[model samples]
Target: MIEIRNLKKSFDDNEVLRGVDITIHDGETVAIIGESGCGKSVLLKHIIGLLQPDSGTVKVDGILIADAKEDVLYALRRRIGFLFQSAALFDSMTVYENIVLGLWEAGERDEVKLRQIATEKLGLVGLGARSLLDFKPSSLSGGMKKRVGLARALAMQPQYMFYDEPTTGLDPVTSDQIDYLILSLTESFSTTSLIITHDLFTVKRIAKRVIYLNKGLIFFDGTPKELEQSTDKTVVQFIERFVK
Candidate 1:
């Protein structure tokens, strides 16, 4: 489980997060939604130990990551898979090399085993064809790049998955494909998934629980049905603008 209490963060004169509290149970898929600059990405960074909170506690499975030792933090991080917004693949590397990079970083050195893992994960993400593995990021389309990124993340077989704007630049058809892939993978691995997105369609399709952050605070937290039925003006307006 992930527990965050009284989380706060600031950048020089700007206070981004203000005493935010949230708990994500195991094997659950949660979506965090908010307008740009509402601190959604900042909160995600804090959870993964990329950013230290000014004053708060972030615990992953009872281990306090806020101030853990480097080794401890690294160990915990290995169990978490982060799919960055831009896919973050190395442009110089081939698709197979990119997928196996995660395993190599985790200290795996056997060539056959690494290739096997990469092949399996790529298959899981619908990039099973052996020929595509040799292609670089430049040759793949946006949706294919996203799939390859996801395949890399899955190579870790992480217990927790974090997606940052998983469908930000895709067309509607590709966005729906990504959404379905996320939902299928979560169930396939029984992984705890947390997605940060502005696309309400993705939220409605995959989120079991929706969290709406506004002005650095959790403005609403409930099921998708409750979010639609909410009476708050901010909530209603956000839904009307994004839900289509």
Candidate 2:
């Protein structure tokens, strides 16, 4: 389980997250939504221990993230997969290399095992062709890059997957495809998923629960249906903008 309590953080003069509390149980998919700069990404960083809060705590399975030693933190992070907004792929590396890079760095030197890991993960994301494994990120489309990133993340067999703007730049069709992939993979792996997105469609399709952050606090926390049906002004206004 991931537990966050009264988390607070500030950068210089800007206070981002304020007294935020959220508890995500195992095997759940939670979507975080809000305007840009409303602290959604900031909170994600806190959860993954990339950013330490000035106050409060973020605990993963009872381990305090802020207090963990470097190795302890690394171990925790190894169990979590993150897909950055830009996909963050190394343009120079081939698809196969990208997928097995982590395992290789961790001391898996057998080429056969590395190839097997790469092939299996790529198949999970529907990129199973042996030929494409030689293609670099620079040669792939945006959606393809995201899939490769997802494939790489899955190579770790993470217990938790964090997706940052998973469908940000894609067309509606591709966006829905990505959402389907996320849903399928989450169910397949039974992994906890935390997605940060401004897309309401994705929230509806991917989230079992929706968290709306506003002014450094969670304005609403409930099912996606609840979020859409909410009568709150802020909720209505936000939805209206997306609905149009």
Candidate 3:
């Protein structure tokens, strides 16, 4: 579980997040939604220790993420996974190499174990055998790259997963596929996930709960049905815009 309390952050003279509070339970899928520049990504970064909050605390399980030492943060990071908006895969690395990079970098050289984990992760994302594993990121489609990124994140068998704009530039079909993959992965791994996205459909399909942020504040926090039935003008407008 993760708890964010009175989280605040500022850049120069502008505040990005203001007194935001959120809690994610173990094995739950929570989606963070809001208009652009509402600090959704910043919030995710803070939770993962990629950014520091000027004021407030991000607690993972029982430990305060903001107060943790560098070594402690590093160790904590290994138990979490992050999938960037851009897929964030190295063009130079093959699919297999990308999937297993973290384990190898952590000096996990048990060839048998490495192969076992890599194969299982790739299979989970619908990737074929080790034959295509040697292919570079450039050789794959956008959706395939996204799947590869997911495979890489799963390689660590993280207890918590964070996704930043997972469906961002993809077509509707592709987005739906990715959402299905997310749902499948969540059930298979029983991992808690924090998905930062503005896609309403994605939120409805994958989020067990949704947190709506506006101007750094949590404007609404509830289930999809609650959000859709919300009378709040902001929530209404937000949902209306995404309605096909």
Candidate 4:
């Protein structure tokens, strides 16, 4: 479970998050939506302990992120997987190495075991062939890179999966594929999934709940149907003026 209470953050003179409150239960798939500079990123950072909130608290599965010790925080992070917007794979690493990088860092030395783990995760993301594991990120297409990134995240066997703009750069078909993968993975793993995206289609397709942030606060919190059918002018305008 993820919980936030009165989460407030500010940068210099700007208040990015103002008294935000949210609770995500275990095994839930949720989407957070907002325009640029709406504090969506700040909120996500707080949840994962990337930034300390000026006030309030962020707790992941009962561990208070703001006050956890270094070792505790490190362990907490091990249970959470973040799929960054750019895939963020190291340029110097091969697909196989990238997938097992976390495991190696955590002191896993068995090469055969690492290979087995990588193979299973890659298959989960629809990249079943073992030969592709030898290829570098540079040789893979955009969608393939995203799938590889997803595979790497899954290698941790995380209880929570967070995706940042999972389909921003893909073509329509590829975007749909990513969306389906996300939905399928959520059900297959029963991982608590939280997605930060601007794509309405993604929200409609996968999210069990939608939270809309506006001007440093949550403007709406409900199901995707309620968000789409909202009569509020702010929600309507955001949807109409999306892609900013």
Off by over 4 Å in 2: none
lDDT of 2 by residue, 1-244 (tens): 9999999999999999989999999999999999999999899898889999999999998999999999998889889999988899988899989988888877889999898888888888877764578898999999989999999899888999999999999988989889999999998889999999999999988899999999999899999999888889989999887666
Q: How close is candidate 4 to the true structure, as a TM-score?
A: 0.95
Tens digit per residue, CA lDDT, model 4, 68-115: 999999888888888888999887999999999989999999999999
TM-scores for every candidate against the unseen true structure: 0.96, 0.96, 0.95, 0.95
Give the alpha-carbon lDDT of every model.
0.91, 0.91, 0.90, 0.92
lDDT of 4: 0.92
Residue pairs in collision within model 3: none
- After the best TM-score superposition of candidate 2, give how far the Cα of residue 2 lies from its true spot, in angstroms: 0.6
Tens digit of per-residue lDDT, candidate 1, span 1-244: 9999999999998999998999999999999999999999999999989999999999999999977999999888889988989998999999989998878987899999988888888888877865677898999999889999999888888999999999999998999989999999988889999999988888989999999999999999999889988889999898897655
Q: After superposition, how far is residue 9 of candidate 1 from its true place, in Å?
A: 0.7
| Model 3 vs truth, CA RMSD | 1.4
Q: What is the TM-score (0 to 1) of candidate 1?
A: 0.96
